[model samples]
Target: MNPRSTATAHVDTFARDRLPPPDQWPDLRFDLPELRYPDRLNAAAELLEGGAGRPVFRTPSGDVWSYGELRARVDRLAHLLTRDLGVVPGNRVLLRGPTTPWLAACWLAVLKAGAIAVTVLAQQRPSELSRMCEIARVRHALCDIRCVDDLAEAGVPGLRITTYGGDGPDDLLRRPAPSTPYPAVDTAADDVALIAFTSGTTGRPKGCAHLHRDVLAIADTFSRHVLRPRADDLFAGSPPLGFTFGLGGLVIFPMRAGACSLLLERAGPRELLPAIAEHRVSVLFTAPTAYRAMLAAPGTYDLSSLRRCVSAGENLPAATWRAWYERTGLRLINGIGATELLHIFVSAADEQIRPGTTGVPVPGWQAEVQDAHGRPVPDGEPGLLAVRGPVGCRYLDDPRQREYVRGGWNITGDLYVRDPDGWFRYVARADDMIVSAGYNIAGPEVEEALLRHPDVVEAAVVGRPDARRGQVVVAFAVLKEGAERDAEALRAFVRAELAPYKCPREIVFRTALPRTATGKLQRFRLPGDGYAESSAREDAGSPTGRETGGDRQ
Candidate 1:
């Protein structure tokens, strides 16, 4: 069967026409029976069915919304969008706000109403948001009442902005609703559902267009096969709904499993621990840095309720994984996923876990290590990680699509070494590889060595231009409070663990490492100074302060 889906329900056709030519698309397979969807499908409608009486979302304000209640809320919002806001099938709707039930509901409503959702983090500045809007040609927005300033400042011409979560007469939540039952838009399974924008090193936004079928495929493949959730489990996480990671772990995955999830607007490590025990959360999803911060914190959190914990966003050092296991008798499930592919395509759960290595691909996906020329590399050799599955990257109107999707494989740009036994160990991003005097050094290997130190709390390694060597390994570290900043001593510590050439000759200590709002390191933005910054970490590195979400797009 020709997998090309030619039929679409999009009336706007803007996003449809922008997709790369059919020849550039990655191979999409639906080997699993559950993955086969009807020609006409609505992802929100499929998920919101049959779990009426169970709690689906809970907030810190003691508000618990059941599946039935959430369905009503989404239907009402859908009605408002189509009836009052003039949204039609295939129109793009920008959703900007902190992570909350209202924001999640808005996302579902947009899909149900046959409108494409563009969910961006609240921390994104006006310029970043504007660029994404321009790229997606967004003409409508539903923003949180408190976060409207930036969207208003963006001032995209002809864009209609509606404020929600306020008492104003025009607010989405307060507006009178139509009493008629809102019928779900019967969209083709292959029709574009949302446009998620992810940035590359050049900071250029690439819009990934995902179909309605792709939404349920991630849940069926990863959540169903690996991070299996029970209907009675209570899920929680730190990634914002804008990120595919959070959207999967917190919303889509749970809803597909008939489970409940607690949505916290501020989900930093310090704030997350207490909320978990208070809410009796069973499954937790966050980054490796957050786990280390939680371990370093002084408080005695009642983490007995936590049954499963998943980590991503950065490589999980074996030391941190062991420490987390020692402190709490739970194994940290480490997985690597990309916004292009939606969620964690490679991960392990329960008995399938192996520390320091990302597990095998999920049930419906296939992964391999390939050289630059797209030829298969030998075992234990580092190469670009290529994956193809039920869902793949379809960058909207971007030339990079040819680079990302090569010969029917989605090249994730991550370097990995696949062992004979099929366990994939992450090396570093392909561009992040450092060549010092012709000796190739993966930044993550050096980072793991630094993280093994007793005083180092957070570490990032990058290459600096050197006169003699083309590039030299440089390490930026955030140490434990009151730890002495002795570059020589730290250097010696790393040399003891790694080869002398692979070790960082110079170390710069800092109070915290810089990260994106979605809690990812900005390696290119690393400062070259040896002095420590006075202020604490901005987003994720600090074990203190309140911040939320992963740079999840």
Candidate 2:
């Protein structure tokens, strides 16, 4: 099972060698025979080559790019990458750009040229990009013209960079290519296609290596069985293309079904509502926080065209789910996915929807709640959530791989409780659980209780060290406009819904809670001196300061 055997002849073998030991990897299961891919597979060939004349992408400004047009553009870009830039199969090409038709073209071109696509978020600072360059040993970058300066600031030695968009002479979009169409390379299904970095909650981000087959496996399992997108359905979302959530929702899922995807450069809740109405977007992918924000301006936009609304990135509280359903009569599709698994493994569609629970495992995967001894916990008990599917974690050269994969399952870091009927209820992250006076307190459970208060706009619960107790549950909350900030009253509100031990010992009022770009809460920033510093930073510039709804997973 040497990973190197499947790598293309032209790629750098460093990544292949860095994969987790064969024993540590989970057994990939493709229950559906069609999920079994060929020995030599090029993902771009499947994503871009098959669709002939259907509309593929549309910009916010109303420009449309059909499948035929996008295919020609991708072929030309692939030719330029191989012929002009000497990019051979297996070389890692960094792709940095906002969500746009050209950015999609660049990504597919890199894969079509038989190179691994390393997608970096456009908002990432130089320091972050510099660290990625070091870890992946990336040497070439295809970036937006605006990000060219940041790439230079990274100061990676011998790093070659190309720019797209803008009126520059050497713009990647305007570069000429040889007339010949560059056929997709024949890469092994197991050959690495992308190196998606995890959100650095602890320390440096770890790169997750995904194979050519893994890309389509997610589409087949989650998209095919659960979401069930149609060719005429228009997909849109707020997630940046760099996020696996966005990669699946905005690009891969749509292309897999020959559906059209609307590309919006700035897709916050405010922007997304109008785009959904104007473009008649059918399937929506976003976090719970965005769904909460959009609930504010009810009846402001025509969202009748939206049939399916998917929520992930964090836990979806039952309150938010109820509020959204009450407002639009559309049940929110709640699922939990991680960077390692590629996309949602557990989810229920329209009729099977459950408000608070994160549904059963998708058709191609198996899940269970495990205790510290690596044994399954009884129903109604909380423990680690472990899953095995066609796609799982393969951290590139990281020792933490041993901690993530145990036995034959990928142990997702979240803590959960499984009911007798097998629905998984999220409690908190393994690290976010507060051990106070020997009582286990799930922070999200307390946060959900606080969110039930009409005056509470947003809330984040964390464990603050206490002298009498090892740690006490403390909450930072943002109140609605003109609402009084009475800590005792808020504490009483929470006590009414939860046990006294689970209620927050103290409530701190804040303009906003710190969250990541993808909208996940930053629990680590809540305790100790970090609280004051984060509060000050939020007060100074966080946009969510005036807005309700904190980011979710």
Candidate 3:
């Protein structure tokens, strides 16, 4: 079948089986026991053992490794780690590099060697790496040659470093490959399997530790209900392996299903599409922004093999979803996950997708909307979204853990509303909500409205401090090609569609809005370096006579 025809068939099947009614969605529940591994539980031995001769991973450089071959290489690497690198059980091993088959193998090897894997972003600077190493007490570091200098600059004491080939001493790459297969050491269900650093929007990064059971729980929950990858399916994506999103999509989910995967040395939209087309990749996982870019790319690429595409990291706008489906005939399944959760907690399977909402909580997890005082809020009322499942989050020596865990629920910083039928709709981060003249406004709602305009390509909403009114909504927008940017005209357009108070009080045009690596808009960085000065000027110029607007909008 042709690409376009196959795309149609896939979408039709998904629409019929997966698209649940917005109001008829079922509540999430965890009825199964938490997954506990035997002390000798190693993912490589568990998943890749029987498929020794089967093709497992294909790299862009035409390097194809079979399951048996990959396992053999992992054995050598694991032996070297323990014998030469002095790595021992419970030791924290820091891995910093781009996504590659070797990196994936290294991750499993770390776990096989009974060490806690701490994956750091390759793009992180010296200062960032140093702080994380100190916080995690990482003693061993492995990175690509490109990132070696930064690690050196970080000055981690007693840190043993190993560099991947493509640079550095060639002799180091010639270390004798160990032949003996490493035995799986006993690992407890609650023993730390991984330590992922949270994206610190509020303050310093916090290490969120996940147990061996958490890894299995994620696969049982989101992967079982949402993805359902088959053994023959090929999983591929753009998130760096260090990120939990990537860990689940590229490694744990596929391994759990005993499937193959393709790992790109560099993952971006440009690189990802070509890999998918070239390798006939079946499962695609990435953020919404990358999907939008793929839709906008000039050439037509064959994406016939893709049976599933998952979107996470940030909210998936309805417009992006419609555009992608219109082009590819596949609805991007939206999911919301955090480092604390280890994998996606809220998601829609191919059979139960809702366009704008973040979908229902995954089975085996309980989610509810609550007020500030931890009281359950009425249905349809926006409240703090809290979740609890087999995979409980434990922060390392952080007092804020108290604020996050109320009773047994982990309070995600997001504000959301649950419809009477059970679908959960994302509103805004509690800190991102703008209160203007007593009105509570969600920036994303305004941004979504703005995106509907043909001229707007991107938009970010932030609250500018005001003296008369506590805060006022201000919008930063990037115009589409050939579109004009007129602040007054844009404000008038918003007023026509939304309530007057919810409309932006001011609009500022920019080439692009600042965003985190995960594609979340960094509202704190919106005002730039002059933010303090701008706020001072606005406070001084505020009109003194207004107190009429109530918080009813």
Best by lDDT: 1
* TM-score of every candidate relative to the true structure: 0.95, 0.94, 0.87
Summarize candidate 2's per-residue lDDT along 410-522 as a digit string, tens digits.
Answer: 88888989999988889888877899999999999999999999987688888877778888887888887788878888888888999999998777778877766667666
Clashes of each: 3, 3, 12
| Backbone clashes (count) for model 2 | 3
lDDT of 2 at 254: 96
lDDT of 1 by residue, 1-553 (tens): 2444657777998998998888999998788898887888989898888478999999988999999999999999999999899999999999999989999999999999999999998977787788888899999999999999999998788899999988889999998998665799989888899888785433567899998999999999999998888999899989888888899999998999999999999999988999998999999988888899999998798999988898888788899999999998999888988888998888888888999998899899999999989999999998998999999899999898998889899998888999999999999888778999999999989999999999999999988777688788888888899888778888889889989999885676677777755567667567532324332333233332221111232
Model 1, which residues run further than 4 Å from truth? 1-6, 200-202, 528-553
The residue pairs in collision within model 1 are 243-552, 518-550, 518-551
Superposed Cα deviation of residue 75, candidate 3 (Å): 0.9
Q: Candidate 1 versus the native: TM-score?
A: 0.95
TM-score of predicted structure 2: 0.94
Q: What are the lDDT scores of the predictions, listed in order?
A: 0.86, 0.84, 0.74
